[model samples]
Target chain A: MNRLFGNRTAIAFLVLPGVAIMVFALIVPIGFSFYFSLTDWAGFGAFNPVGAANYKEILTADPVFWRSLVNALILMAVTIFIQNPVAFALAALLAHISQKASQIFRSIFFVPAVLSVVVITKLWVNIFNPTYGILNKLLRLAGLKSLAVSWLSNPHTALGSVIWIIIWQGFGWALLFYYTGLMTVPKEIEEAAVVDGASWPQTYTRIILPYMFPVISSVIVIDVISSLKQMEMIYLSTDGGPGQLTQFIAVYLYQKAFVASQYGYGNALSILFVVVAVGITVLVQRLFRSEGEIQ
Target chain B: MNALTKTPLFDRSAGKRFGKFALYAFLVVFAILQVFPLLWVFDYSIQKTGDLFGPELIKLPLVPVWHNYARAWVDGKILRYFINSSIVVVSSVLISTVVSFCLAYATTRMVWKLRTLAAGFIGLGMVIPIHTTLLPNFIWFNVFGLINTHVGLIIPYIAFTLSFNTLLFAGQLKTLPRSMEESAFLDGARYPKILASVIAPMAAPAIVTVLVMTFLTNWNEFIMANTYLSTDDLRTLPFSIIRFQGQYSSDYAVQFACMTLVALPPLVLYFFFSRWIMSGATAGAVKG
Candidate 1:
């Protein structure tokens, strides 16, 4: 009896604060979101329940929602195909260098990773500005003035430019992961491959890439999640402008709820957004199953 | 031995040295591309508009203006925003760390079904987005009359991130042997005492990492803060920066100055904790 009492009291003390906060702050809000999604609430007045209409409208009629989804998918594809390959190559190069050089370059590469998103977005936006910006100025100077354009404002290029900025900021992190993973590769494996007359490219393709599968999968998963949740850079640079060319789900939903005053519809969009994000994350994890194979 | 004695392909010789030189040259060019904007921002912060752009727009700021920093800090309302940000971040850190430490300890040490249920429930929080819950909470806060306050913002922010923090901390705590706590129990120490006196010190590095992550999230957070905070005085750095843009539309110098002020604190703090930040980032990714 004493042991039970002692343990129960101890457990209560340990958990009560976190539980209280999580229930009120996290669980309750989500519950409220569900309840509100079934209503006609405009965020500042009397309201009534209008169940499931919001979801139907968003699913059937909302062009912006579909556009945001497509943009996010395009961004994800670019990140996985272009960014990861470049990052992997750089990481391999870093692994081959001397310690002093590697350390210096590692810090240099990581500056973008550690910088605030606000600074990075503003920096790139300025660089890509159409008039009086350095990019245009340089293009003109080099007799390539025809190429310069308003990168963030042009409908044709805005999404690509915004996606490029996100990948540029995130490049260092992917590089860092691959570099760190490469550092942990046992030297003996490389030596054995060498002794067997394996070339450098073959060693990397056959032996090293297999060993680094877990890291690669993790980075891919992160990229997928970040792609689905990308709001800040898009919001800052373009604000889903030029007719929502650069729209992402996170920013789009916020605009609906706050700006468009369609609170219930926004909530429905958000719930669907969550389902897609979680669904993609789980799918990626299962597809890889590289975790168990990694020793 | 004879085969091993043949010239090594990856020799530390002239060819390799030249190859290294090529690699360094590539890295230097990339570094310049990466750092160019930041250097421009810094240089622009000191100059007038005339010096900013020219036929040769790449020239360094002709006359440095130190007043931009002073004006940004004073008139731009950055100080107020900084204080507001600190209030939310510090309070969130202190509250989350204490609550999570206790919860993590219970989840690891308790052999009870309730503990299992509690941890399981928290795990669902990992995937829930803030947008999904924002409207409902906004409605609730209006009824409770808690809207536009630091407390209102802190509550949801901490709640939203608690699961991941608990999972990180609890995984680390579980790695410690149970015998240490059992011995403490045998010697007549209480659970809180064991956590306070024993577990915390050893788990210091992990705790620090969690704190850094929490700080970064809070510092960079804009969505919740923008929604919840209606008062100018309660706005965070990000919110204030947006306002700064509107207020100084054409003065690119002052706008860049505001950005400099906004970017400096986190940059300086990151430099100090660069190693820990890298380790924390890698560990979180690898462990996940």
Candidate 2:
């Protein structure tokens, strides 16, 4: 039995394939990415080694890089603050309603999240269209013509518009998480809190939110990572347009490498992207860690 | 029960009643905001391209221009892209799930050296976003002559998905009783036999969860497909709508139709398999 279970050939066949795929697809590429980052290769034959020059420029000289990094932070803040609170409140409201209504509303809200990112982005792009979009059209119909600005093209509104698309799609998932967490909160706790003459807000703040700390923190951690890594919606919607006002790290690196053909410089940007993603993920997880969370 | 009856669940005071009314009002408005945009998409998909220019919120064509669907399918290149998407997503989901199942079983059930480290390495892949590898992969696929091919795209899709897939399988496989496999082994059932008959049936739900998650990620994946595959035949579903929008810039109805076609399958899939996705996703979230 031991031989059968621990058979070296069996273990080798099973584990190595997955490990090999990961190493080839993930680990080895990062190695190549690092190697390429040291050079000034512009996607062609000969290239001189520029060791950290790209990094230096990106850190000190590059305004776009800073803009991208700041945008990610802004996204993280918006998701954690604006998105979560609203989703949590909506979820609380959903919980109060009958089960049937809650299910219907939940499913309806999640439709955008479940749709393809391309579809969602395109859908919103059409809605925000200055000329023919329903949003501007409706505003004009309501005699609010001045309010119907070009959402994606305008410098002031571009970042907010892209961020809105991201938030709108992700809002449902946030609500679902909070709702699920609320569901697991024991009914008896609320009953006890109320029996002690605690007001509704007091019961939620002390009893419920404390119990929901894990769910909330985990959601926040996900928000931080996703915010940093977000590229698809921004890429499809704005491509970091309006004087790079909407640039995020992923999209910025993509344009630099592929569009500008500054392959080496883009590689440098990507390494920094990974650093930020991992650093923030770890920091947030640490903040949320309480008894036994850390392995 | 007795304690609950004294205070009751929700207060019945006038202020509390007003509060409930306000909550309902907020929820209904939010629900409308959520569904209204989607309804507009359907509405516009049937309207004439000329009619779509109007400021009317809801416009119905005298005769619905159902031909937009045909144009999207034929002229927009959606059919081919849809096939490409299915091929890539299915191949990635199938291969990754099997690969992950093998690793999950090996690390969790069977004995091995450095098993925890192996599992950890696999799990670490989750954090490795595709952007990090985009340029390197572009160069790598360039050298290997894998560019613009479905295989090139599927390779990374499978690679990125393995971590989460393995996590799900490992979570489910760890909780399953070894007694089933052990008893089967006593009957001289080999690894393949035991896995197919004993392990797999038990992990079926998780397999579905992994399948759904992997499928959705690959199906909606835009950047990698956009980066790796440049040719028309190799374009995936997401790009079909984007490309259609660009090529037929003024054909708003056709663009909306293309978007609907791109969205329909996943919407249908969600409708049927939502319970599986919801329960599995929440469990995964809490555990993570």
Candidate 3:
């Protein structure tokens, strides 16, 4: 048993498969991506090395890349600032309500989160259809004829509409996180706060919110990463359409590589994307770290 | 004992009740908003395009057009995509689960020199977005003759998923008593035997959590499946649904029906295992 269990070879064998897969499928590919970012590869046939021209071009000239990053940042901001607070408030209310009602609403809220992205995006795409959508019809019914427009096509509303779909689908998970976090906040803490003459807002702001900071931070981090990686929804709905108004980095990179056949430029964009994503994530962690300590 | 009722600011009973009512109303409205789109899709799945328009947009189908489902399943090639999805999802889930289990076991249970390094390597995989690797993976897969193959898609799925699932398993394994494994070893149960009999059973809940999460993720995964597979026969459900929508852009009922078909399995799974799904999803938040 000692020989069998204590063997380094045995441990190596146990860990090898997962490590190998990650190295082969994940690590090696990123290395190749970095390598390819330097060349003018069209994804096929012969290609010439362009040094950092691809990167230079993307940094200075590519409006689409900038737009994609801006859209992702807007999404991150909306999710953290808008969705998080709303979900947190809803979760707090749900915590205060009856168990049966909370349970029902919890499941209802989570339905969109659990469903396939294709389904959710397509559902909204149809609903946002200008001519025959329920939204436009309802607006016309309410005699607000000017309110209805092509939700996904119009430049003014396209990003907002896409953001709504993303938030709607993602709202439940945020709610779930906050609800679970709120549930674990012991009753005595609130009771103690009340006994100390803390106001309702004061209790939440000074006590409960601080206590739930870890959960909040983690959720925010997840939101930032997810917002940065927004792909399938944008892909299936707008495909970064109406002149790339709703372009996300993930979708734009794919389009550049596969659709436009500019593999090298796509690689450069992806490499930069990776840097930005990692940089933002680390920054968020640090931001939360100092806040957690301060609180 | 209610927190709101006990608050000093809500001195008026009517105000407290009204506040509670308002909260409930807000929650209920949000709940409806979350679910109503899917219900709308369900409604559209059964209605003719003609009925889908006009004031009847909010109305249900007087007689259910059940044939829409059959048409979507048979004519839309959703069945093929379903099979393709299941094959890829099941294979990848099984592979990732087993590999992660082993990796977790080795890292947690054994005293290995490279354990921390191994774990860190796996953990690092999480931060790197899949899109960053897409171009290179496409080029590499094409070079390796894996283009338009399920194996091509499954390899990356397992790679990307291994980090999270392994972490979940390792967390579970750490909480299990080391004494149990030691006693099992003393009883002449070898590493493999101990793993199968001791660790596996103890980690059943974690295993299930990983399995369900992986299933939903693999089921919903679009970008890789879309990028890697070009052949119609190899395309997964999400890819197929997108293709079907593009091709039959005018057929609203069929498109809705096809979406329903593509979405049904995970919805049903969520309905049954909502707790597991919820916990698995929030696991990162709670643990991190």
Top of the candidates by TM-score: 3
lDDT value, candidate 3, whole model: 0.87
Worst lDDT run of 10 residues, candidate 3 chain A, spans A1-10
- Cα distance off (Å), candidate 2, residue B50: 1.9
Q: Model 1: per-residue lDDT, tens digit, B99-135?
A: 8888888887676778778988776676666666666
TM-score of chain A by itself in each prediction: 0.93, 0.95, 0.95
Question: Which rank order by TM-score, best down to worst?
Answer: 3, 2, 1
lDDT of candidate 3 over B1-288, digit per residue (tens)? 888667656467768788888888898789888888888888988988667775744977888998888888886788788899999999999999999999988888788677788888888677889888888988777888988899999999999999889888888898987788789877878777888898899999999999999999888988888788888888888764676667877888888888888888998999888888887777778876
Which structure is stronger by DockQ: 1 or 3? 3
Candidate 1, residues A90-186, lDDT tens digits: the string is: 8898888888888778777888777667778888888888876788888888898778878888888888899989998888888888888888789
Instruction: Write down the TM-score for model 1.
Output: 0.93
> For residues B131-205, what per-residue lDDT tens digits would candidate 2 score against the true structure?
999989888777788888999998999899888788788888889877887789889898888888889999999
- Writing each residue's lDDT as its tens digit, candidate 2 over A1-295 gives 6887788888898888899888887888888889999999998879999989999999999999999989999999999999999999989888889999899888888878788898999999999999889999889989999989999999989999999999999988898899999998999999999999999999999999988888888898889888988999998889999889999999999998989989999999988888887787777777778532652
Give TM-scores for every candidate, taking all chains together and pairing residue i with residue i: 0.93, 0.94, 0.95
Better of 1 and 2 by TM-score: 2
Residue B74 miss distance in model 1 (angstroms): 1.9
Measured against the true two-chain complex, the DockQ scores of the candidates, in the order shown, are 0.49, 0.62, 0.63
What's the DockQ of model 2? 0.62
lDDT of each: 0.81, 0.87, 0.87
Residue A168's C-alpha lDDT in candidate 1? 89
